[model samples]
Target: MNLESLLLNNLHRFPPRVVAWIEKRLKAIPSIRQKIDKEYDDMMGGLESSLKPYKDRFPAFTELPAQGRDRAEILREMEAMQSQEEDRWREGMVSGAVYHGDQAHIDFLNRVYALHSQSNPLHADVWPSATKFEAEIVRMTANMLGGGADVVGTVSSGGTESILLAMKTYRDWGRAKGIRKPEMILPVTA
Candidate 1:
């Protein structure tokens, strides 16, 4: 077999820490580092156009203006940008972007957001209502899922936060069980 294929076939035989160290050493080589950097740059260059379509069309503020812009003008610009970006998701061209795209559902969500925009659930003592809302939502979800009274959860802001929280919980649980090293197997997509 070829050297590359042979090394890859046996790579799993090495300890993870040793493999990581080897990888770090290989990346330290100037030629290898340059090739990796070039690959990253090329990938990002191809994505830049789609990722920042409004970069040239809209103004980007690095620092605050000496004087604040008019509120109405700012709102107009924001709404225009939002309208442009929301089209793909609204038409269902983008998957998972909008779970429910009905105008009435969006309007109702917007109204609820407006009502609690300033409330921070982290400060439960100050915003008990936010905490109460989250608790009720969690309880209802648990009941619907056929969970017993022992099933409890906290509300996460999004999928990423939920994933992070779950990972931390697992890590803590492993440690409590006297596991010195904890490893997770994740799909390539994750």
Candidate 2:
């Protein structure tokens, strides 16, 4: 089977430990490593063309321009791209994106983003606004998910990061409880 199919098959069958073990063994052999690397590169190259359908529509950034252009010209080009791309999302043709699509709503959000564009949460002391946004976001989400009684959580980026954080927490808990090399069993499905 192809490498992608093999990876997906193993992912479906085994937990992370077994998969990592298998990957380690396969990469230990030079020939197997080379074969898998070549297959992965070929797969990625074939997928790139389909993934980057807008490469031709926008600048591909092959090389930097020798000279800088006027800010108005650059903004005009970007506006054109934004207008061209907005129609699909605004019409709800794509999935799970552009929940707020009205022009007024979009413009309001863009203005808010521009206002807070320089803010970074990592430096919460300098960007106290980011801290406020984070707290409000967490509060709103918690209330939406039935948070009146005992639910409490900090804001995280998304599901995968949250899962990884929880997994690490549990792993540390298990280690503290004197479990050696603690492994988790995840079920396999057809």
lDDT of 1 by residue, 1-190 (tens): 9965786798789998998997798789998799889999999988998898888887889998999999998999899989997988877788765789888999999999999899998899999999899889999999999998988999998878889999999989999999978878988688
lDDT of 2 at 59: 70
CA lDDT, candidate 1, residue 81? 89
Question: Which regions in candidate 2 have their CA more than 4 angstroms from the true location?
Answer: 1-46, 62-66, 147-190
Which pairs clash (backbone N, Cα, C closer than 3 Å) in model 1? none
lDDT (10s digit) by residue, model 2, range 1-190: 9986878766747887998998898799999899999999999988997677667776766688788777998898789877877787767788755566677997899999999889888998999988888888778888998787455567776766888888888999898999889877766541
Indicate the residue-level lDDT of 82 in model 2.
75
**Top of the candidates by TM-score:** 1
Total colliding residue pairs, candidate 2: 0
TM-score of each: 0.80, 0.55
